[model samples]
Target chain A: MPQSMQPGDAKAAEIKAVSIGKTFGAFHALKNLSLDIGRGEFLTLLGPSGSGKTTFLMILAGFTAPTTGRLMMDGKDITDVPAEDRSYGMVFQGYALFPHLTVEQNIAFPLKVRGHSSADVKRKVAEIVERVGLTGHEKKLPAKLSGGQQQRVALARALVFEPSVLLLDEPFSALDKNLREMMQQEVKRLHQETGTTFVFVTHDQSEALALSSRVAIFNHGELLQVGKPQDVYERPSNRFVAEFLGEINLLPLDTVELNGETAAGKFEDRTIVLNKSITLAGKKAVAAVRPEHMFISASPQTSDCNAITCRVEGATYFGASTKYHLRTRSGTSLAVSMPTASTSPIAPQSDVWVSWPVHQGFLLPDGG
Target chain B: MIGKSITSRKILLLAPLLLFLGLAYVVPFLGVVRWSFTMPEVGLGQYRALMTDPLVQSVFIRTLRICLIVTAAVLVTAYAIAYVWVRGSSVQRMLAEFCILVPFWISVLTRAFGWLAMLSNRGLINTWLQSAGIISEPLALARNELGVIIGMTHFLIPFAVFPIASAMRSIDERVLLAARGMGASRTRIFWTVFVPLTYGGLIGAGLIVFVFALGFFVTPAILGGGRSVMVAELVYLRIFQSPDWGLGAAISVVLVLFIGALLALMRRFIKPAHLIG
Candidate 1:
């Protein structure tokens, strides 16, 4: 929770990207994206492929120059500085470990390049190797190590220099699921230990949510939203952000009206209430709720909850939870997930009451 | 049994190539080896004479020296060209490839003659210098060891460029970027990371150019103008000019053994996989 310090606190803004845009010929890779990375914060740029997240990371690393923007660091513009002069550490996708160098040499490269004494290089390399749990594998080449081991070497190499900022470009994308999770925990621990500003890019939403203090959602070269993981996931600003984060049930609403700190709208025969207070620019809106927030039962659980009657069309059993796919009378499809141990075996075709807290549902402009 | 049969079938597919090499290369080489030993009334006299002859010793020494110089020069020049080929902009890469391949497609004799036309005394270079009043006399730019070295280096640059460029192309570009991001300067990245990664290519190209330079016949013969005689030219002289078949065969055997020893020495430094790559 190092990001608890708000980005608006000017002193905490370690790196600020202002009005960044990149275009190649006729194709725009990134629009005028503006963001602030707080000091010692773990911020993940989450998006689908071709969302220009990687392009932004490259700009921050100084590997790619912005077409029109000013990159500020410590209140100074660094837009024209080259990558080598920026002194930021980067872990590229696929690790990019030096194939010809041994693990120790690979980790020692940055130190040696900075003209550290041989003794200092050796001591630092040994220390980081042990920190990454690669003590015994120091003498091996990258090709001789496993995928996870190579990833550790890449991490150790990037962190050994004690850079002020660390940028990772999908470092764990090549690992198996188990190893990727393990590496994720390792990176989280490293981030806490180093207290360095970390900007990570990944297409995997779960990884973005689990590791980052704040996740910035991107799509089609635009910065859609940036916020704390829970805030963004629970209350996405648009349809793309809601859908990209995870499975969400969207029900069309009509005659939407804004109340003091809530919005009341109608969905067919049910009156839907959203907890967020916002100005409505259009009459049409959609009620958005995560599948996990909704529950299926034979009867409505409480009066405070928004409830709808739907026919269960199908159910999918995941080891930990059962997902019931339901369709309302108006032909709006919805999904409700319940813990397997707590749910009764509701057969398909059974009519049920799907209920959720009114505060859990949010409203988005329809088709946005 | 099935595995054995499959292996045998694969070997059978190599029958024609094996037959051709055995007849065209191994068989003639065996004859030369036999003549080196048995010629001149079944004794090692020719080899003993080779050891004592000053002309043969100087020729061998000079040939080794020239080949070493050419190999070094070709490697340094080819590495620059190969780097441009792999990492340059599209226009630069196309220009580099044109420079390498255009000369490569032209015959060696044509290239040697071209060098002669430019470098020989009273030729283009000398005539231009004289006309420009830069020199009172034409310089001895050709018809010596320097001429031989220049011609051989030019003839062999394209050979060295291919392997070096291929090796450079195989390097993961991210490794360089990673180094740069870690604050390594461009020069440090090139010397420490880029060059070391292409070591396999450098070694492979060096071996090819050095081996080819050792037995170079046309460039040295035409450009040397009978002065700088390499092992191959000496072998031709002894066999065809002096008609001393036994001495020539002895020299040829020694050359082959020298190349074999070089290969063995090089194998200690490079892995077979690196050579193939």
Candidate 2:
């Protein structure tokens, strides 16, 4: 965590895209999108399927040509440059290791293609193999290895050449849960140690938040927003980003009044204030709060908290936390998660008070 | 318990095939083997004579040489066509697939005759060249080793493409993309990644075509013009023209043994399980 606070290394490479667009027979895979990838920054493209995040990553890697716009690396136009000329390392979703090649040979392929000497290739391959914790698997074919091992081989191969940028397309999606977490840590450590620019694509929001310095949310072939993980999570620009990042409770409010940057609204005969008023003057509005931010109590606790009376319909236990499915008195379904360690269990079908600080909620125009 | 019943059911289903193979193929082939060694007071006499006979030796060598040429030609042509079939657009793939399979739907004899029509002296190619003033006279395109190769390769392309394209299909498209991303040029990716991954298909197709070509009778008979007699035609001539059944049986036995030896050698050199397993 401390390492993430440090600025990117000065030697890191930067990539810039200017108004990139791609169309395949009138199907717009990527719209007119522009973004700047900082040197040595971990940027994640987060979206559901068909959201064009993978297409954008492909365009960045030069595997796909943008229908309109130019890509620049260090201010040099590389829009038409082929993938091989870009010299970026990529780990595909399936970890596409050459089936015939042994792990060592697979890791050495890029170096050998780059005309590295045999000794240099060997040294680099050995170091990367060890770095990726695949020391004894050097001579084993990819099919002979486990899925996790094959993924490690892919990571090692991609990182062996010290490429200017490393692009990963859901590298851990195929891995089991434990292996996925382990690989995530491994990738983060490698990114930290090498300080190479990394552009990762995944639909898993937790993965996007955990591994990236900046998360770019995509939906319907358009970029919704790009910012730091906390910024994006706490202050999503629209309803899509808010609900997509995690479990959110959207409570409809009426007669909203804006006061500077804050807004007060009436919901279920109770006055509630939202800290961030991003809604218009006279439009339907909803106050969105993440499940973890809301609290469920037997009775209202504080005057400062925006509280609502709800009936606890059910509870799902998650070891460290419990999520209570609740329905407000006015019949809006909502959920609130409370840490099991600090909160007592609430019986199902019981009336409860759900409350959170006004500062924890954001206002968005309804039906966003 | 369920697994045992399923396996028993599978064996029960296999009973008919096992019975048919035992009666129809194994029995007759065993009879041929017995006749080769036992007929006309034979005790390795035919084998010894076959080794020493210059005519038989030439036929054997010629069969092997022609099979090698056919296998190589079929492999190269099939690899190109299979590559297109796997990686090209749907239209291009359909066209390539259609061309490769044209020799299959039509009978082999018909295709050979078609080739003979186009390749004979003063045939379509020669006439075109002459009319276009590219040459002074007709070229000998048929009834030679070149003609045999052309005809055989054409017939074997579809067989070769099946295995190669199946192998190519199993290769992840992203692997090639990853190679390109890692600075491998298109040509480099083909040789290093694409070709090596498809080695299983190549070897399987190669063994199939080579073994098939070694025993070919019709293509070589029509296109060989008697000057390039292969082993199968030699066996035919010994039995039908000269009325030497024992010699023909001996040659057939040798051909089977040569094929077995070649398969054994190929197994030793390349383990077939590496591709499939």
What are the clash counts of all predictions, listed in order?
A: 0, 0
Best by DockQ: 1
Candidate 1 clashes between residue pairs 3 or more apart in a chain or in different chains: none
| Whole-model Cα lDDT of every candidate shown, in order | 0.90, 0.87
> Candidate 2: which stretches are off by over 4 Å?
A1-10, B1-25, B118-141, B261-277
RMSD of 1: 3.6
**The 10-residue segment with the lowest total lDDT in model 1 chain B:** B1-10
> Residue-wise lDDT of candidate 1 within B1-277, one digit each (tens)?
1245567669888889989989999999999988888877589999999999999999999999999999999999999998898899999999999989899689989999999998899789999999999999999989999999999999999888988888898889899899899888888889999999889889988998998899899999999999999999999999899868899999999999989888887778776455444
Please give, for residues B1-277, the per-residue lDDT of candidate 2 as tens digits.
1245567668877789889988997898788777678766668877788889999998888888999999999999999999898889999999997987776789888988888889988678988898999999788889999899999999988888888888898888888888899888888888888898888789888997999899898998898788789999998898789857677889988788889988887776566544332
What TM-score does chain A reach in every model?
0.96, 0.95
Individual DockQ of the candidates?
Answer: 0.86, 0.82
- Count of backbone collisions in candidate 2: 0
- Supply the global lDDT for candidate 2: 0.87
User: For every model shown, what is its TM-score relative to the native structure?
Assistant: 0.94, 0.91
